[model samples]
Target: MTVRSTAPKDTLGEELVRFDGVVKRFRTSLGRRQTALDGFSMTIPRGSVVGLLGPNGSGKTTALKALLGLVRADAGTIRAFGRQLPEGQALVASRMGALIEGPAFTASLSGERNLRLLGELHGVGAETVAEALELVGLTQAARRPYSGYSLGMKQRLGVAGALLAAPELLVLDEPMNGLDPEAVRDMRALFTRLRDERGMTIVVSSHILAEVELVCDRVTIVRHGTVIRDGPVGELLDRGTVHTVVRVEDVTAARSVLERAGLAVTAAVGPQGPELHVGATAADPGPALLKVLAEHGLYPQELRLRQASLEDVYINAIREADAARGATGAAGDVG
Candidate 1:
């Protein structure tokens, strides 16, 4: 099955990381080859917060690890900070920091000591260590042994380590995994501050669609080891077909009124009463829609617009991929 991306071509002069036809492969059980990534290409803009979303076994982690030089790609070129990766990768990676899975720390070491050791490795001074701890809201727990910290606190300490280098690019994989609701909110604020105040570029990978929608400027979705969608979050949201539910006193009359005005109405009974579902256009439906309804004297008691959400898009992409694969298998059997 082939996955075709619907994303538009990105304009020049905006890319920070560029991958052209990148692929990665490994040996699987029974000595068969498995492809983790296939022709994955993308250009992440500088200083932009991009949400990398995919379901389990979708190769999101493989893509990130390739960027960090932890795994080498079998084909294609990856350029970061205007240089080819894994060669000038050291110099380029120095300007980047990441929390790939979770914090790896000595159980006996105090949080502060662990941070100090990381700071030293990154050439960060003592003052920088203190600042990193404060930035992650881990200053109070800085003196406690890492083994005593909760899962959320351990995640925070990992974030602090990532910040210790004061990197230009930060890559986080499920940074909010163990966080509570309040902590998730706090993490959002921290990401905003990092981009607004410090001018940092962030690539966050998560399965939490709503949180990604709230925080990301743009998103790139992958499924079955291929990129399915990539674009501005707002554009994707706006492209959704608007579905409006309307409740009126006269259900039959309401349908006639809306139909005459060229609005598609479906007769479906809602909680309030029989309602009409309107599938509005891709563009704005406000002025023309309201004028038509008002002209017909069908006073709607309730009117609400529903559209596809980030989760909707995510699910559809994966389902489409599965359907394509099923069709291909059927064709192969026929052949």
Candidate 2:
């Protein structure tokens, strides 16, 4: 499939958040200027699940903090729910539930009490707090002291606090940071429910690519404070040409047969069995490859097509960036 230069704008339909060439910077203790974000621009559509992914110090948090008005952008514009941020920050933030670096609560207080206090601060009632607890599957742990709660429980409480106000947007930074496998699965299900049932637009930021793959409808990958890839999860994964994997009893013979058939064999490896990666021009290469293998009496155990994963794409983008930087350095030295 041919790759498009630009992503279709109407994919999500309505805009809930937008950043126009936003730049943020700070001064270090020694007085050197540090730029955290430079000309960052993005638009998050309403009611869509978006994954914000980056390595540590990639400005993912900076982008979120700027949108929330916790940090001001040195240049450009930011808007949330169609209003300029911080100016309408109170109004916009009131409609947003966020746990940027985990939620804070009194360790001595019970889960219910902590949420009760948070609800009162948000001008919500006790019933809202109880419902939020139930929504995050914390009802059974509601009476437990915050000090005794597990890391997962604390994360759930953070989510509960976000839900207390029935906000339109949910921005969670590493919500699954310390969660166990079961807790991660539960959180995934809860996010799905919140999106499909309640129609809440959720933005989840995490360094875990697989979890993001499972939870997000679309993903934006950032590296060194820049977005390298942004598009639908399916389309992004479907980028580049197609390839097939063949698992056969005789790896060597299979390679010979495929090569003779004019198929480009990209990779071949195996310990328990032999495997060959063949570049394909068509979707189904099974019939042609199978016939070639059969001619040599090489019956294959398995044959499947493989696509580049988000992790693979992300690594490639970073490698390209590194190469570009190196090239620039070399040119400067020559000059």
Candidate 3:
């Protein structure tokens, strides 16, 4: 099918990939049909790192596979590089590279040799393979056989393979998997440099929310085969509620006081012991919460407003989507 470019005209730059209302279904071993993608849509802007995040079995891999034409969607369209997919896949194949799930290689071959073989197929040479290995910090382990490498090393090798072609659009699924803390940090920096120095558009799907928040410019959170939330990371986090965290000698008493004052409260055991989180509806709820607690003869050791973290935003988004869906179903039943 011919897919037209529906990207908005802008100085920012045209979107490199667009999956519009895509739908994919599969038959399970139990003879039941399961929907893998339900009207899923996403736009990948040029020179940006977009994080695709979702829970397990939430269609994250399915969507990425569909984008790479590894699987066909029963409906909807996928356009990339101003060209229709599958039909134009060959034309744009050289410009795109991907590492899905993991990389496969001859176990007996050295890491460097595996990359070299992969590069050779794409007309890439030894120099490109070496550079890719170095970029992923795999230079020291390059001569080691694939079977001898650790899990983290294997992950780095996979990343090296994806970069072998110097692709303009790189798609990585769980790129941070099997990486240590230091390797994770290095990978984050590498992704940033690829976007800044190489001007590449990277689409990364990962369960590592904090890393995604740190490295990605934008994020799209999906659930049940559809997008629940999609926007710039900063914008989405900034729009979240600023919660008031209270650490007091009497946790139960503080919670009672806050709840009685018509404030929403949740109690949990933090690093500092029992803590109460009060939803801050006003610009500053600290003073009000403090005053109310004082009246009850309870003193707070600390009360602070905490900005929402990416994890908080993700949880809230999933909850909001579930609530909205429930409401829709309820309305449908009434009608």
Q: Pick the candidate with the highest TM-score.
A: 3
Which window of 10 residues has the lowest lDDT sum in candidate 2?
Answer: 1-10
Ranking by TM-score: 3, 2, 1
Query: CA lDDT of 14 in candidate 3?
Result: 58
* Count of backbone collisions in candidate 2: 0
Q: For residues 21-103, what per-residue lDDT tens digits would candidate 2 score against the true structure?
A: 87777777777677777667877877688999877777788899888778988898999878997688987777788998887
Estimate, for each residue in 179-244, the C-alpha lDDT of model 1 and write its tens digit.
888888888889988876666789999887899999999999986667888899999887655677
TM-score, candidate 2, is: 0.80
Residue 329 CA error for candidate 2 (Å)? 4.5
219-330 per-residue lDDT for model 3 (tens digits): 9998778888899999999987789999999898888888888999988778978898889988888888888999999989999999988998998888887787687762
Clashing pairs in 2: none
lDDT of candidate model 3 versus the reference: 0.85
Q: Please give the distance, in angstroms, between residue 104's alpha carbon in candidate 1 and its true position after superposition.
A: 0.9
What local lDDT score does residue 103 receive in model 2, on the 0 to 100 scale? 79
| Candidate with best lDDT | 3
